[model samples]
Target: MTLIYALEIIGTFVFAISGLRLAAKKHMDLFGATVIAFVTAVGGGTTRDVLLGAYPVAWVQDTVYPVVILLAVPFTFIFRKYIVNLKRTFFIFDTIGIALFTISGMQKALSLGIHPGLAIVMGMVSAVVGGVIRDILCNEIPLIFRKEIYATACLAGAFAFFLLDYYTTLSENIIYLITTAIIIIIRVVSIKYDLSMPKMKG
Candidate 1:
């Protein structure tokens, strides 16, 4: 498989795990957790595909995505104790998932003749909308709605991808790696330093 496709599968798995973790914490049953995992894995991509008029959506076309999510549910259950013991497990997986999804989304958009500016927006949407849906379903405030640098990190990565692809002769794989790393680094640093966008004043 191509690097981007592999990354997309990995992203789906991690995002499903993140959602399953939350569902477990919420005392959800297996079916509910599976639902949560499915949405969290592909909600953003589904939204992006619909907006871009890419019919059938992504997970709809590829059985692999659903299979990955299904595997994630059992994996999360089997590793529940270990996952619970890990500090920031949800954040780590979610961050990595978004970083990878951002690159995939932008690349897809650019390939489809989307404008760079809109492509950046699509990238951010692909990265964060899943988490947004996950949070809403879990009855928590979505991270992007908060002042945290969540979607902003995705935006930065998307811009980096655009600039690198436009100006440099770097291989596509290298660009993907650099963009993903940038998003993950920005996310980690922002959370570590308790950094966030300024709150709106009344």
Candidate 2:
């Protein structure tokens, strides 16, 4: 559990740094960048926790969360030039983070006796809300909307995780690894092909 907590916290920090770097790119002040980063890191988990009734929220209880985010601010500033080009790099890491988080969310929800349908929704929420918050803070449309495959990839992974869970023949670690790989594969292919949800003409 310690290692799991460390990884999740690291994911949060990476997202936070990514968001702060973006804010810096837009010439935002330190405070604004910090806010953006902090929100981006934990927004998805917070949303998932709320929906799962897993309150009063994970970050609220963990002191390390805010501290790690605070540490990310300096890293963002110091590496502004490199970090600014991180749209591609961040996409890869963020995708992995969500995949892991998605599986974790589903496992937790199901263990707590949640319905499968709702558990699936929880997985997607856990996966993508970080980018949504980052986009909102950066004054851009949500990434999951513009890049439809991002969330959908997570959804696909969530579904696969559910199927694996239903069978339970696979080891827990194997299931999670497969679920993450499914998300990464779908997202990479979608981006490569410029795939998107069809725009509607209202």
Candidate 3:
């Protein structure tokens, strides 16, 4: 499979697991957890596709996305204790998911003849809208709505991907690697240091 397809699958799995882990923490039942996982895996990409006028969206076009998410539910349930106990488990998965999806989304848009700037925005949408919807459905404050540097990491990575693709001669693999690494490092460092956007003084 191509790197883009691989990233999509990996992103779907990690994000689904993240949603399942959160659902477990919230004491949601199996059905509830499954719904959350599905939404968390497809919400962003679906939104991006719709906005870009990509027909049928992704999940509808590919059965693998939901299948991966469904499979993740059982695996996560079986290993709930181990998965949840890992250091920064949610943060780690969420960061990786965003990193992978951001570049994947940007590449998709670019392939469709989208402008680089708009493609970057689409990439951020694909990386962040899922988590936002997941938090809203769970009745929690979405990280993007808070002072957290969550979506900013996605934005940075998408911008880097755009620049590297348009202005440099970097190989596609190198561009993907660098963009994903930048996003992951930004997110990890932000969490470790409690970094966030400055709040408005009320």
Candidate 4:
């Protein structure tokens, strides 16, 4: 498979795992967990596609997306014990997934001749909307709505991607790697140091 397609599949898998992990914590049944996993994997992409007027959406056009999520559900259940023992398993997976989704989504928009600014917004939406839906379903404040640096990281990555594509001589694949790394690093550092955007006083 192409690198972009592979990255998309990996993103879907990890996002699904993150959602399944939360569902498990909520004591959801297998069916409920699968539903959560499915939404977490495809919600953002679906939203992006619909907004862009890309009919059929992504997962609807590609069976691989659903298959990947199906695999992730069982994988999460099978390794629940090991995953629970890992420090910040959900955070790690979610961060990586967002980084991947941001670049992939931006690339899609760019390919469709979207304006760069809106492409960046699409990238952020693709990265965060799924998690937002997942959080709402889990009855928690979405990370993007919180003071955390979640959506900011995606926006930063998208901007970096646009600049690199415009001004640099780097290959497309290399740009993708750098953009993803930038998002992941920004997210990790922000979380590690308790950094966040300024909050408004009441």
**Model 4 alpha-carbon drift over 4 Å, by segment:** none
Clashes (N, CA, C under 3 Å) per candidate: 0, 0, 0, 0
1-202: candidate 1 lDDT, tens digit per residue: 9999999999999999988888888999989999999998899999999999988898888899999999997788789877755858767888999999999999999999999999999998898899899999999998788877888889889999999999999999999999999999999999999999888899
Candidate 3, residues 61-141, lDDT tens digits: the string is 889988999999878878877777785776788899999999999898899999999999989999989988999889899
Per-model CA lDDT versus the true structure: 0.92, 0.79, 0.90, 0.92
Error of 3 at 103 (Å): 1.0
lDDT of candidate 4 over 1-202, digit per residue (tens): 8898899999999999988888888888999989999999999999999999988898998999999999987787789887745758778888999999999999999999999999999998898899889989999888688877989999999999999999999999999999999999999999999999988899
CA RMSD (A), model 2? 2.0
Q: Residue 4 error for model 4, in Å?
A: 0.9
Q: Give each model a TM-score.
A: 0.96, 0.89, 0.95, 0.97
Model 1: how far residue 166 lies from native, Å: 0.7
Candidate 2 local lDDT, 33-130, one digit each (tens): 88888888888889988877887798899888889999988876687666667678766767777777777777767877999988889878876788
Q: How accurate is candidate 3 locally (lDDT)?
A: 0.90
Q: Candidate 3: deviation at residue 13, Å?
A: 0.3
The reply for model 3, stretches above 4 Å from the true place, is none
Over 4 Å off in model 2, which ranges? Answer: none
